[model samples]
Target: MKVLIIGLGSIAKKHIAAINKLDQSAEIYALRSNPHSKSDIAGVIDTYNLNDVKVSELDFVLISNPTSEHFSTLQQLVEFDIPLFIEKPLFSKINEETQSLVDEFEKKEITTYVACNLRFLDCIKELKTILKDAKINEVSVYCGSYLPNWRPGVDFRTVYSANKEMGGGVHIDLIHELDYVYWLFGNPDKTNSFFSNTSSLKISAYDYANYLWTYKTFSASIVLNYFRKESKRSIEVVTDKGTYYVDLLKNTIEFNNKCIFASQKRIADTYYNQIEFFVKNILIGREKFNTIKEANTILKLCMKD
Candidate 1:
């Protein structure tokens, strides 16, 4: 399966690296929209023409480009009819314009998948399975980091995370929490979200986002921040009888049952795990990853104010 990756940005490089690790048989090709786009991938020859991105030659495509143009780009791919694996926060922001296009994709029954990398993530995956049928008393996740520290080489001022037009904010940066909340528990009738760039920092986008979901059976709260000394990604699911914690950095799962216990060292790469799932669905007609429609719903929910 030949794979074509568009938008050779920071995330695209990681996706390329993971793809190389997952499957060697699949050929990798890279593309950037502008001839002047500064790409990080070494030894890669980039061409600007979209026609050069032959949808027929490639079996799959990863649309990792900045979201301001995702709608038009996606519409072009819809015409091509090849399956797409889009990254998180499907659009710049949810609105009537994007909703109508999403609805049309559903009606045509196109084969599409969205990248909620954490869904197939090893640490998160184990925790989801262990707590699938269990009771949840509380769910809280902490996702934060010093923006400048994200890429040790690049200056934070130049990154997309600090730009609003590129959909770089706590809402999109830390939206995994929102997606996983709905993944673990069903959709909530309502979600209240408040966001701000608390420090009045140099950045124009939000630095902190706090979301609260009040459900009939249980309540959930998530705090996402991009201003901090240390980088942390952790989730704690508290139940009636016990609690579970996933230390993403450590890639370990530990459950505190007092007398009983459960834990595992994660072996799968989250990126590859999700990519493998998507590839399997394409190759074998299996429902490995979340559908495009399901991902769109998650996208819409995260856009709620």
Candidate 2:
């Protein structure tokens, strides 16, 4: 498969790494607005300019650009009617007009999948399996950490995660939680939230967002942030029968019976799982493992709400 990766940043690197690991022969070309002269992968592969690159030849166009720039970059892409993997939030801010673009993509039979990496987490995939028969009443998640600690070399202030206009911040950045939570639950209407950039760390964008979601039959809350001493990512699902706890990094799921008897399972990586599912759907006429319509809908809520 031939693929063109845009914005050779962190996620782009991870995507390349994940793709190569999955399929060594997947012809990969990368593009970035600003290429680092000292970067290791700089010389080994060819990088193309947006103006020069022919979009139709590429089987997939993966846009890993900053959120705010997504719409404009998408503008350049929409004309080609090719499959795309757009990273997270459809746009920094959503409007009626943006919906039109999404509608057009669908009308033209262009498939677009939002890259919500958490959706590819082993824990969540199993949680979905466990809840397949059980009746789920609620779901909650906790994800937060220091922004400066996120990257090994860059300053937090200059990184895309710190700029609200660039779709940086807990609300937009960690918003995959919101998107996927809706995927697990349904649409959220009774929503109350408390989010702000409290620390002097850099008050450009909201660093924290705590959401209290009131579903029709269930309830949920998520505490997300770019502030903390330690890094953490966890999810808990409470059904009428029992509770399922997932420790993502540890790749373990512990079922607690009043905090007494329990069972746990360690999960293998699901990164390639998500990629293979996508590739299969593209190659064959089989049903897609994930839907772009659903993704675009969640992206709507993330950008608008």
Candidate 3:
């Protein structure tokens, strides 16, 4: 399959790797601003301009550019009718124009899948299964990591995560928590959130955010930040049966102080699985997870005040 990737950033690299692992014969083409800095990664053919690409022969397009550029990129590709594999959060912010584009996608019947690889994690999948029949009472999700440590040798202040316009805030950048929360529990009856640059990090984007979602019988709270000295990504769910602790970093799920599920796989595995699923669905002309409409709903929840 001929695949066109719009960006060549870290996440884009991961997607390339996943695609390579999934289908070695897949011809990977990239449209990059600085195509001169062409990728050394095997199986990738870099193009200096979109005009150089044969869009008609492309099987799908992966929008892995900055969140701020997603809309413009989509605007250019909207008429192509190619399936899309968009990176998470959909956009840095959503507005009526974004909604109009979403409507166009629906009107055109585009097969678009927004990335939410966390949903493919074994631990998360197992937790979803366990809570399927349980009466949920409360859920607390915490995800934090030192921003500077995210990309060694790179200034955290210079990265997209540090800029609000580029969609670098903890709430938007770390939206997997919100995505999976919605995946597990569906939409909340009411939602409230507080997010701001409450850290010493030299960034314009909000480094910390807390969200509360209320359901009919249960409530969920999520805390996200980019300034924890020690990395942590876990979820605690209280149900009628018992509380279950999920350690996303450790890839383990525990209940009643006993371990229940452990995948022991690197987080990249989930990315691979997600891409595999996306490619498979594209081949079958259907997407079962994180469609643009579904992701837009979660994006609205994130942006909800």
Best-fitting candidate, scored by lDDT: 3
- Sort by lDDT, top down from the best: 3, 1, 2
Could you report the Cα RMSD, in angstroms, for every candidate shown? 2.7, 3.2, 1.2
Query: Considering only N, C-alpha and C atoms within 3 Å, which residue pairs clash in candidate 1?
Result: none
Candidate 1: global Cα-lDDT?
0.75
Taking all chains together, each candidate's TM-score versus the true structure is: 0.89, 0.87, 0.97
* Tens-digit lDDT string for candidate 2 (187-299): 88777778788786865888988888887777788888888768777788888988888776666677873332222433234556656666676534445433456666665
Q: Judging by TM-score, tell me the better candidate of 1 and 3.
A: 3
Candidate 2 versus the native: TM-score?
Answer: 0.87
Best by TM-score: 3
Name the lDDT of candidate 3. 0.89
lDDT of 1 by residue, 145-180 (tens): 788887898888777788876778878877777887
> What is the clash count of model 2?
0
Candidate 2 residue spans exceeding 4 A from truth: 34-39, 42-44, 257-268, 283-292, 303-305
| lDDT value, residue 285 of candidate 1 | 76
Q: How many residue pairs clash in each candidate at the backbone level? A: 0, 0, 0
